[model samples]
Target chain A: MGISVLRVENLIKRYESGFALDIPHLEFQSGRIYGLVGPNGAGKTTLLNLLNLLEEPTEGEMFFEERRFTDLDPLDIRRKMTMVMENPFLFHTTVFKNITAGLKCRSVDKKMWPAMSKEALRTVGLKGFENRYAPALSRGETQRVAIARALVLKPEVLFLDEPFTNIRQRDIDLFEKLTKTINQEYQTTIIFTTHDLPQAHRLSDEVISLVDGRIIEGSIENLFEGTVEEIDGTQSVKISPKISVSVITEKRGKVNISIAPREIILSHGAIISSARNSFKGIIRKIQMEGQTVIVNISVDEEVEFTALITETSFKNMGLPIDSEIYLTFKSTSVTIF
Target chain B: MDYILEGLGNALKMIVSLDSEMAEIVFVSVKISTISIILATLAGVPLGFYVAIRDFWGKRAAITILNTLMALPTVVIGLLIYSFISRRGPLGVLGLLYTPWAMIIGQTILAFPIVAALSLSATQGIDKRVEKTALTLGANNLQTALFILMEGKFALFSAIIAGFGRVFAEVGVSMMLGGNIRGFTRNITTAIAFETGKGEFALGIALGMILLTVAFSINILFHYFQKKRM
Candidate 1:
C-alpha cells in the first residue's frame, strides 16, 4: 500500500549440502508486523539471516529504502534493525549492560540509558531484573530479557527468528500484546518466524508462507477453515454452499486446510482428473513472480485461494481477470491443522 | 643420605630468611613471565576469536597448525630463538643475546601458541549464536570479535595463567637466551638447574618448591574456569 521498507528479488543461498533458499521476489511494507510461517528447513531463518544482513545471498539483489542493500554500509543498515535469535545469548555482563550494549554502541545519551533500559525491562515483563546476572537467568527470563534488549533499541525493523517456543500461554498472550503495542505505538515493523500456524494467524497483520525455499505468496488469505462434513466417510470441509475442500484426515469436527498455490491446477472448463477436490472460482487477481504467475481465485463470495501457473499456460488459456475457472487439487496435497 | 638432609635443612633456612639472591631471581622470573603472558594474551585472544568465528579457505589447516603448536617442545622454541639472536644469526645485530629481554622474547613465543590454541578451543565451545547476537545488536566486525572474546573471558584468563605457568617453570629458553646470568637474568628454573649442577641443592630445592606452588595455583584456576564453562 505504501513504499516498501525491504524488498528482495531473485534471492538464492546455496549450501554445500545441496540445500538452498531460492526466493524469486518478496516485499515487506512499512510499519506492519509480518510473520513467516513454515516447517523446519523451509528457509525461514535463511530469509531472516539474509534480511538482517547477517549472511550474503548467493545470487540476488536486496533493496532497503530504495537503495541496493550491498551499496549501503551494512553495519549502518544492521544498526537500524535488530534480531532476536531462537537461542538467547546475552553479553557476559549484568542485565543492565545487556540491555544497553546496543545503545552504548549507537552512542545514545548516557543520561537516558538507565531509565530507558528499566522501561524496556518492564515492557517485556522483566522488571526488577536490572542487576541480575545474565548467565544465572532462567530460560524464560532470558528470552524475555532478550526481547527487552531488542525492543530498547526501538529499531526500524525487529526480526525474531523462532524465539517463542517453550513459552507459556500467558507469556504468549503477553508477547502478542507487546507486539501489537510496538506495532501501534512505536510503529516498529515486526517480522517473526514461527511453526505455530495459529500464532502466526493471530500475531501477524500479514503472513508469508515459505515452503522448500519459495515464498508462498497470498498464503495467509488462502487458509480456509470450516466445519467438517463426511459424506460416505469422505472427509471434507464446507467453507461455503458452493465450496467444499477434501482433506486427508479422518477425525474432524472443525479443521483448517492449507493448499500450496502450486498444487492447485486451473482449467477453463471441467477438467478430468483422478484428484478428489474440484471447485469453480473466478480469478480475482493475477501477478507474475519470476517466470511463473500467481492467480488468486474466489470459489465462494468470501473464500479466496491462489494457484500458480506459467505465463505460457496463462497466455494459452487467455483468461482475463474475473474469468471463471475450475481449480482441482489432490486430497493428499491438502495439509490439515 | 647426610647430603640430602643437609640440603633440606639449608633450603628451609633459605626460604625463611627471604634471601635477596633468591628474591631477585624470583623477581626476574616473574617479570619476564608476566610480560610474556600479557603479550600472549593480547595477541592470542583475538586470533583465537577469529579462528573460532570466521570461515575462510585453509582455516582447517590453520587450526591444525595451531593445535600442533600447542604441544611444541620448549627446547625447540629455545633453539629457534637462539639461532635468530645468536652472533652470525639473522637478528644478531640487536645484541640482546644473553639479556633478560631475550628470555622475555623467547618466552613470549613459547606462551603465544598455547594461549591461542586454548582460546580457540574455548571459543569453539561457546554458544554459537553469540556472534550473530552481537552483530544484530549493532557490533561491527571488530566489535563482534571482541564480544566473542568477552564471552570466553574466563577461558582466556585461564589461558594466560597456563601460559604463565609454562614460561615460569621453563628452563631451556632462559638457559639458552638469558645465559643464566645469576644477578641479572637467572629465573627459577635455570637457577635451580645451575644450583643442582653445582651440588648446591638448597636454593635449587627452594625454587623448586615455589615452582610447584605456582603450577598448583594455575591448575586450580584452570579447573575453576573449566567448571564455570560447564
Candidate 2:
C-alpha cells in the first residue's frame, strides 16, 4: 500500500561452513511493519544484516528508495537505518554516552546531545537513567537503552533481530508496544525477526516465512523434517517416532514438509472423516491472534502441531486446555519440499 | 651476616635520606623506560589493532612472529642495536652509541614486541558485537576501530604496563648501550650491577629495593587493569 523503501533481487550469501542464503526477490514498503519468521539457522539474522548494509551479499543488488546500494556510501546509508541486536552490547560508559553515540558520530552539536538523549530515553520509558553506567544495567534495562540509542538517530528504518529472545513476558509486552509506537509516530519502516509464529502474525502487517535459508509460503508452524517412506502401499512422512503424516509425494529420502494451520480440522472426538491423515492429540496451549484462535496440540507427547480456527468455532467447540482432541487433514494439504 | 645486616641498615638510611646519587639513578631509569614505552605504545597499539581486525594471507604467521619477538633476549637486542650504532657500523655517523638515546632505542626494541603482541590479543579478545554495534550506529571505519580500541582500553593499558615492566628491569641493554655513564645514563639496574660488583653493598641494596618496589607497583597496576577488563 506504500512506496517501496527497500528491494532485493537475486540475493545470495555463502559461508565457509557451507551455509548459503538465497533470495530470489523481496521488497519492503515504507511505513509498514514486516516480520521475518524462521527457526534457528534459517538465515533470518543474515538477511537482516544484508538489508541493514552491515554485510555485503555474495551476489545481489539492493535498492533503497529506488537508488542502488552500490551507488551510495555505506556509512551514509547506514546512518539512515539502525539495528538493535538480540544481545545488545552496550558501550562501557554512561547510558547517556551510549544513547548519544550515533549523534556524536554524525558530528551533531554537543549542546543538543543532552536534550536529544533525554527525549529518546523517555520514548523507551527510561527517563532519568542517563547517569547510570551501561554495563551495570539489568538485561531489560540494557535492551531499553539499546533501543533508545537506535531511536535517537531517527532512522528511516529499524531492524530488530530477535528482540524478544530471553526477555521476560512483561518486558516483551512493553517492547511490542514500543515497536508499534515507533512505527505509528515516526512512520519508520520496521523489520523484526522472530521464531514465535503467533507473535509474528500479531505484530507485523506482512510475515515472511523462511526455512533453511529459503522463503516459503504459509506459516512456519507445524514444519517438520523427516524421511519419506512407503509403508503398506501408503506414502507418508515419519515426522517423529510416534507420528506420521500421509503425503502426496513421489520423492523419497529426507525431506521437509509443512502443513498450513488453517487446513487442519479440529474435533472433540475421533469421528469418521474423508481426510487421509488424522491424529489424536491433547491441547497444549491456546492463543488469540485477532479473529483467529491458535491451538497447539501435542501428539503422543512427542510432536506438537498448531491449528488455526475462527474465534466463533473455537468458542462453540468449547475446547479446554489438556483435553484430548483429534486433528485431521487431507493428504494434499501436506506440502513436501 | 653482620656485613649483610649493616648493608641493609645503610641502604634504608640512604633511601630515607634521599641520597642524591640514588635519586639521580632512579630518575634516569624512570625517564628512559617511560620514553621507550611511550614510543613503543605509539607504534605498537595501532599495528596490533590493524592486524587483529584485518584478514590477510600469512596473518597467523605474522602473529606468530610477534609472539616470538616477545621472548627475545635483551642482550640480543642490545647486540643487534650495538652493531648498527657502534663506530664503523652503518649508523655510526650519528655517534648514537654510549648515550641515553641509544639506551632508549634499545629498550624500545625490547618493549615493542611485548606491547604489540599483548595488544593483538587484547583487541582480539574484545566482543565481536562491539564492532557491529558501532558501525550500525553510523560510525565510520576509523571511528569504529577507535571505538573498539576504547572498549579494549583496560587490556591495552595492561599491555603497555607489561612493556614498561620488561624494559625497566633489564640490565643488559642499559649496560651495553648506555655504557652506564654516571649521572647521565646510569640507571637502577645498571647501578645495582656495577655497585654490587665493586663491593659498594649499601648503594646496590638501596637501588635493588627501589627496582623491586617499582616492579611490584607495576604488577599491581597491571593486575588492577586486568581485573577491570573482566
Report each candidate's C-alpha RMSD, comma-separated, in the order given.
Answer: 11.6, 1.9
lDDT of 2 by residue, B1-230 (tens): 88888999999999999999999999999999999999999999998998999999999999999999999999999999999999989999999999999999999999999999999999999999999999899999989998999999999999999999999999999999999999999999999999999988999999999999999999999999999999
Please write out the lDDT profile of model 1 over residues A1-337, one tens digit for every residue.
7568899999999989888999888889889889899878889999999999999899999988778997999998999899998887887789999999889778899999999999999888888999999989887788889989999999989998887887877777777788888788778889999986557867898888876676764344356768789889788888777778887687568766678778889998878889999888899889865578889888766688878898899889887998899999898888765
Per-residue lDDT, model 2, residue B226, is 100
In DockQ, how does model 1 score against the reference complex? 0.53
Location of the lowest summed lDDT over 10 successive residues in candidate 2 chain B = B1-10
DockQ of each: 0.53, 0.90
- Model 2 clashing residue pairs (backbone): none
lDDT of 2 at A162: 97
* Residue lDDT tens for model 1, B1-230: 99888888888888899889888988999999999899888898778877877799999998999888887888898899989999989999999899988998989889888999888888998888888898899988777777777787887777777888888888888999999987899999999999999999989988888889889998999889877666
Model 2 ranges off by over 4 Å: A228-235, A249-254, A288-292, A310-318
Query: What DockQ class does candidate 2 belong to?
Result: high
Task: Tell me how far the alpha carbon of residue B142 in candidate 1 is from the true structure, in angstroms, after superposition.
Answer: 1.5
- Candidate 1 CAPRI assessment class: medium
